[model samples]
Target: MTHPEAHKSHRAGWLRAAVLGANDGIVSTASLIIGIATASATQEYILLAGIAGLVAGAMSMAAGEYVSVSSQADTENADLAIEKKALENDFESELDELTEIYQTRGLESGLAKQVAQQLMAHDALGAHAKDELGITDTTSAKPLQAAFYSAVTFTIGAALPLSLAWAIPGHLLVISVAVSSLFFLALLGGIAAKIGGASITAGALRVTVWGALAMSITAVVGNFFGVATQ
Candidate 1:
């Protein structure tokens, strides 16, 4: 099987993460708006809730993505630092370690040793970083970049449903929001799954199931509250 190396992997991986975060943000926030709208709440109250959900969800997603990506970046940096020191102070041992690693992969002992020696002689740190440490040529982390894209894409996706609900009237508003939001989520899942070389049906099914659950539970709660107060 083709290892599907990093340069291509990076784009698809980032696309998947962005789609996941944005789709969740959109679907959950839209479902909240739908649930509240179904509660027979006045337009103003529903709109206020939608606005609040949008702002809170977007900011929360941004902060969470930032923290998660930062953690990954920190770990990679730590690995790089440790590796740099090993290469500097214990070069021979490090070289032996790399040679053995190549042998384990598939190379014969003599060939592994020769390959390791050449790699080290050419670029010791890079070779070890990829083979030994699992860091690679094209998959480095960029926390700020990830955070920005997630937040922006999420806000855009969420606005679709919120805007629809606000502009429409009565129970029809809720229907429009729910149907459109589900369609968007399913489309996102299929596109992202295709990009990642995964199953479209699996992707669509997973997102649709979660969206259904969220909307159903929220709608039930809203209906109960509506009945209790009336």
Candidate 2:
């Protein structure tokens, strides 16, 4: 009999970082452009602001992802090191620990011990790491990968709004950016959710609604400042 295919939990690491970075890039850059346009800023100034936001946002995403994921990787490595030492110092207890874990997962006591013995004989540290500590190969953290994906995706997403700002006239810039940003946000949300096996409509609405609110607030603030300065 054929076994069922495994789920895509392995993609969680980079997919989540990339999607978040892209969404932030689109929303934040578009909002910045819309805000500046609403404030009666010149087209040149608006485009410059968008470019600045894109560059800053991408760099921030990269740095943030790298630091956070690196911390996680460090912790995982420390835990594995501790577990390895434990296995060397107390092999019997480690084997019993694995056996208990299997038993908790519904294996019979005798069978659990037998299975644990076999696994320990084959790869003791691997068995402990996977079952006891929940650190598998797929879930192992990679800081560089996360950082690269986040920065690249952020740049790509930010470029969309910047391109529109460059092409659209000043008079219509705010509305055009607001609408287009929402569309892109919704699209990205749907695509990311689909890849992550979540509800598409929910994801789309979630990002679009928040994106609209963000743009709306920024526009209002810009208009208020514009009028005050005038």
Candidate 3:
């Protein structure tokens, strides 16, 4: 018999970090450019600000992901270690525990015991890790992978706004960057949601709305400060 299609939950870990990094990179860099441009800052200053934001933001995302995912990994390892100790100290209790866990998941008592026995015989730690700890191979955290994807995606997303800021004329810099950044955010959000098997429209609209708000606020602040300075 054929199995039905599986959900995309496996992509949860990296997809979240990657999407967040990209969204922040685009929104923050674009907002910075628009804000500086509204302040009547020179092209050099605007570009400088975007570049600085891109670098700083990318580094921050990377470091944050690494630390957080590393902590998760550590916790998983600790739990697994405890389980291993318990199994070694009392195999029967551990076996019974596994059987009970399966039963709770809707298996018949006899079937649960049989299945647990077979699973434990095959790989006791693996069975316990999968059923008891809910730590499967797909959902396992990888700090380095998270850090690398976050930093790389952040850099790529930030580059879009920075490039527009550099190429667009001064007279049109603010609007151009704002529009382009929103477009990128929407696209990224839709793509991320689609991959994650969610509503594309909701994701796209969510990011775009937030990006517009951020840029608008920064622009207003910049304009106020510019007029005040003058």
Candidate 4:
């Protein structure tokens, strides 16, 4: 890949983090706001609930991502340590074990043996780690990093609609949030696609469509309750 593309993929991790974080922010926060709004249209109450939701939601996302990713990182570290010890203790046996793994991947007997022989000569530790242990393309669990990214992304997403509600007329509150949320979702989809090297048009279409469906369902529920209560 070119320099710019490599830069983008490096940013890809952040992009993925943002997408997951923002998506949770939008859906959960929107649902919470709508549910709270249904309970009472009082602007103060809605605003209060939105603020509380933002803080709680962000904290929840951060804590959850950190714990999960950290656990994965721990497990991977443990596996790597064990693999290293096994290599140090029993070199020949480990070499044979690596050969069997390649055989399972459908290499002919002689070819597999040659591969094992050459790979062991080149880097015995790498060979056994890749074949026997299944930890080739490594991905570390970045719990703290993920948590920070998630919380920030979520806060940004959640704040958009809440700010719109505050700026617009109270009577127009719900519609504004609905419209702005769709706009953000579409923007998010396009950004996500571009980051992942996917078709932006398709990504935008799918996410916006789903956002519409979600908002519509909630609207139906809101109206049903609105009428029933009256």
What would the per-residue lDDT of candidate 2 be over residues 30-121, giving only the tens digit for each residue?
Answer: 88998888888999999888999999999999999999999999999999999999988999999899999999999999999999999999
Q: State candidate 1's TM-score.
A: 0.92
Q: Model 4 segments beyond 4 Å from truth?
A: 1-13, 38-40, 100-127, 130-138, 221-230
lDDT of 1 by residue, 104-190 (tens): 889999999999999999999999889988887467777777777778888888888888877997868877888888888888888
Scored against the true structure, residue 125 in model 2 reaches a CA lDDT of 91
Candidate 3 residue-wise lDDT at 192? 98
Candidate closest to the true structure, highest lDDT:
3
Residue range 142-229, candidate 4, lDDT tens digits: 6778899999999998888778766774667777788788888889889898888889999888878877787677667866776678
The order of the candidates by TM-score, greatest first, is 2, 3, 1, 4
lDDT of 3 by residue, 25-45 (tens): 998899998888999999999
Q: Sort the candidates on lDDT, descending order.
A: 3, 2, 1, 4
In model 3, the runs with Cα more than 4 Å from the true position are 1-6
Which candidate wins on TM-score? 2
Kindly report which residue pairs in candidate 4 clash with one another. none
lDDT of 3: 0.94
Q: Model 1: number of clashes?
A: 0
Pitting candidate 2 against candidate 4, the one with the higher TM-score is: 2
- Compute the lDDT of residue 103 as modeled in candidate 1: 85
lDDT, residue 115, candidate 1 = 94
TM-score of each: 0.92, 0.97, 0.96, 0.79
